[model samples]
Target: MDELGIIEQGVDWRTRLGQDIRDCMINDILFSLQTKLQSTSTTLIDLQKVAARIEERIHTIASDYGDYLRRICLTRGDLDSYDVLLNDCQRQQASIRSSILLHQENKQGDQIVQAKRNTMGTSSSSVLSNQVALNDHKEHSHPYEKDMISKLPNDLVQHIMSFLSMREAVRTSVLSHWWVNQWTFLKSIQLNIYWFHMDREKFSSFLDKLLLSRVQADAPMDTFELKSFAIDRANCWINHAIKHNAKVLKFAEYGKWEPFYLDPNLVELSSRYLETLELTNVALDATIFSQLANSCPALQNMLLTDCLLEVEEISSSSLKNLDIIDCYILKDLSICTPSLVSLCIKNERTDNSSFRNSYLIFATVIIIDASSVSSMELLAMDRQFTFVEKDGGEPMFNNLRNLSLGLWCINNMFSPLRRFVRHSPMLRMVTLRISPLDWKSHLTKEHQEMLISIRDRRGLILYIDWY
Candidate 1:
């Protein structure tokens, strides 16, 4: 081969070697993380078991104290202290569970990286072997170069930082002066509080400082996500991000039952650049939707899960996709998003929740005014549901192409599935999924007949699956 060809082969070999080394490092890191995660999980489980045993013992003590332990001097405060200890243990358990979930997310990313590494290894090994001879001859010609990653432009470094978690990205500052400030220019910031071994106050303070620094640097934040148990303290920080034109905003609770409430003012101010918004375990009122439609012209997608909807109606215009999951407090849903292409409503069952109280009675009505919707999914559990259609007008989902209904929807007195098939002239597919409990009992012969009738008449396919 010519000198140029040999040189090119050597360079390629070096590149492949670097990539292989990086992949090996990544594998080592993943192995270490998995080991630590397993250890932490075992410890947390042990703590929970101990806490349960302690509680059982305390119960026995309380029961025997009134009669047999009167001779001793154990007061109610002692029992209360035991209860407090149990609560602390429970809190720690919850934090560990959250951390586990965060690690699981990272595990998926690691799998993707591993898959790429495997593909590269398979394709480059022969080429690398052939270049070994060329490498010896070119050793003096091309001396060891500076790290290519360190030589990357600031913009490229910032772009790379976008894929990393905020904690990992910020830690890159320790590498060199060039990277010390590059993380501040990152467009995406995603942090899970439980992943860091800091107290809530310190995490909050860190977020405050980070957001403040970004604002001072005039950085354009494309995404801002925070998952924490204590979101009340970060309300101001969220508001700041919205005001600064963050395009995507996501906030979710870590381990609390109570829903977080975002003031209407905050939602209203989040209109400018917010294209996607996701909130879990949030308490919302009726006016939240209308406020978004009027204020957030750029908004396209909204997801509310495990939330407490304190109102009867939800309506929007600018939103293109809407997802309402595990929100039991909403008695009615009114969507008027002309831009909507997809809608999903799901229920999370709770034994003693208010949603259960309306089981034997009419509970909620869903009215959709979106003419552009092409996909719809509903899982209302056992609640009574009514869909409002315009009087003496065409049905809303005339353009809908896909539809899904849960077990409760099949039992609705309104026959929502039949109505959907009758109205949705463009519907190409229908899927019906039932819970295991419902499938064993509630799936009737009549339901099967209805499914066959739709397929024969509409010439459409049907699917039934257990969920």
Candidate 2:
């Protein structure tokens, strides 16, 4: 196009004029653009001014907010200080109150102790007065002494003296006049001679004083107890208990301490009118027990502990309740009394003698303490003494109503159970325990069948507790 020289063509007439007009218009546009550019720069400068003002205002606000934050921090410190002081005051108050309560409790304890001390002192003084009164009566001699002494207004003296033990009663003679022979008439004699020499003669002499006094005094005895007494004096004391017809008798012995000598005749004589009898740690041949049962026709309750009772036939004509505890040497036990209602035997703790043969000697043995039950409990040994199947066949004790068997039993002598269930055709309930490891497996099919029959026939509950 440049080679064509189009620019040169504008030099021709009207075209040249038109070209001059366009150059003028271009100069006007350039001038207008310069004015608009200057206006835009001024507007930009105004906006910068406004932004600087706003930035200054924001800096002032931020400074004020910082002051407010400082004030809040100060207020917060004051509140924390107040809270700490208040808490300390509350703690101090609580401590003071606790101290007051402790003082009050201490005062109360002291008052109780003082009261008990005063009571003991009064009792001591009364005892001394009795001693003095008794001495005056004894020191003054008289042929009518026995009658006069008996006639004196001395019921309080006797009542007070009754509280003393056998040894203390005898020692009363050393006190004064009236006390000289006061112990001779004691009806309740409880002796505690833990250190009595086992020399037979010396013991017999000591017993002579007790016996001769009671005999001369002619007091019918209520209780005669020889607790852990020496063996030497056992004969004399046993004789005394028999002769006096004691009502409640408790005899206990332990350790290598002297053992008591027991006689069938003595037991019979004493037990004739006995109501409760408790024997612990005494060595007795089985023969004497039978005699005792016959003699104690009125016996209501009996307890035996750590004893060697050779009783093959357990018989107490009127025996209603029996309790045996840790009797290591028990052998050939039997129960013949229909009157027997409540019985408890606990041997799980420790007993040297368990079995000469199978544990089937006892009718039923229990594993746990049967004491809680109202009825008789053969307890831990419950299963041990149960019957093994004999050629004689099923036992026929149809009278059993409530029964408990132990988990340790072998030779599943459901014999006693079956017997009870059979005889007591209308039997109410029976409990059988079977230890899976026990040698007896009769508690298997046959036992279950018998249980089902009993349940169906008598509507009896057959409970089986497995070990």
Candidate 3:
């Protein structure tokens, strides 16, 4: 009996000792991991606090700004509808004779289309010419049929002169009684005022006379184009025309100008009942952009140039095509739009060291397509955003079918592309827009090889454009 007890006690002792060693080993490993994890947690918490403080500062800075930011902010809120809106807006037929007025087979595939050089002039004839030189010399002198054809139906004349400039239409009015009243009722009032044509004062005078007459005479102005200049006159002109519900507005001011501010009341309007708005300016502010995102409910197409949209995050469920060109002061870009199809984001650099701007520096611009967005074009001339040695990133986008980008975005391109490529394995067409070939001449042989290495792996459409 004593021998049996001793055997049992030894067995129990062995099992207990084995368990103690196992537990001790686990505790030692766990203690080391806990120490490492604690250090990491502290670092993360510190980062989070810094980020929060930076964000707070950004908000405070913007809030402290004058109405300058408020006015130039791109928004469609509270726009006041005024002056000349079309009488027959419900009338769907643009014209009874629906024929292809002009069609030019573009040779420039997909370059930043030369502004004036690219647009096709509307004409009744089959040929596409730079000018339709049909001037009756009599008002300068008139053709014999001027008196008779002048009485042609108002709608017919409106249709006929839809393609003609306001100057041509004014001259046409001098021809006959029939044309006089119709010219005053033009459906589209084009203010194609070139800076080269007149000085600033002279331009302002012309705009005032034209806009006042349109409002006073109640012209059916549907489209406005005074994109070349940025005077107080242009501001007033846009202010008036937007009230009239001009559907197609273009102001591509690629040329530089003296920096100026806008009237805040102008930005905060209630009458942005249009489909498209294209603005290329010196710079844009944040609030106006936010107001616009809030106000413009039916907007379809939008373009921004050399501008800044402070909306940090953009969410448009109805917008289709968005073009951000040379916009440097954009950060915190978050967009979730179902109906968005084409998105083109150009220069995305911020030279300023403001936290909002810096955070936006290498931050990823994400795009989600629940709608019909098939085409994506991103053009960056240089490393758009500022980055430090430990900036810790590259740009990334997901679910894009057609991706177009400039090859030099470096971390901005590679990081995002790597993730996007993996996430969107079904991406079909990727286009790379090559800038002036002058870039290649200065690059080292190794750099060129590295570029080739990236390209060799990803089959993409390379589009080269020479300045």
lDDT tens digits, residues 165-256, model 2? Answer: 75566555544455576776677866543323222233334556657656766778888776543343454576577667888887775332
Q: Which digits, one per residue and each the tens of the lDDT, describe model 3 over residues 155-271?
A: 777788888876566555445644444554567765443422323344455556656666777776677776544354455566677778777766644232311233445545234
Model 2 spans > 4 angstroms off: 1-184, 195-208, 256-259, 264-271, 329-331, 351-374, 380-383, 386-402, 408-467
Per-residue CA lDDT of model 1 for 1-467, tens digit only, reads 23432223333333323334334433443343234223323221222322233222223323232221221112222222222122464577678667755555676576564443333322222222222122222221113544345578867777678787655564554345355556656788777665443235545656676677677778887888888653455567678778878899998864232345666655554457889999886767666755676788888889988776666666666778989886655344455677789988866555443212311222464655767889988766645445667678677677799888777666544276788777788999988877678666875777667668868888888887676
The local lDDT score (0 to 100) that residue 237 gets in candidate 1 is 66
TM-score of 2: 0.49
lDDT of 2 at 58: 26
Models ranked on TM-score: 1, 3, 2
| Over 4 Å off, model 3 | 1-146, 228-230, 252-254, 259-262, 308-311, 330-332, 347-372, 382-399, 408-413, 433-467
Question: Considering TM-score, which of the candidate structures 1 and 2 is the better prediction for this target?
Answer: 1
lDDT of candidate 1 at residue 291, scale 0 to 100? 67
Better of 1 and 3 by lDDT: 1
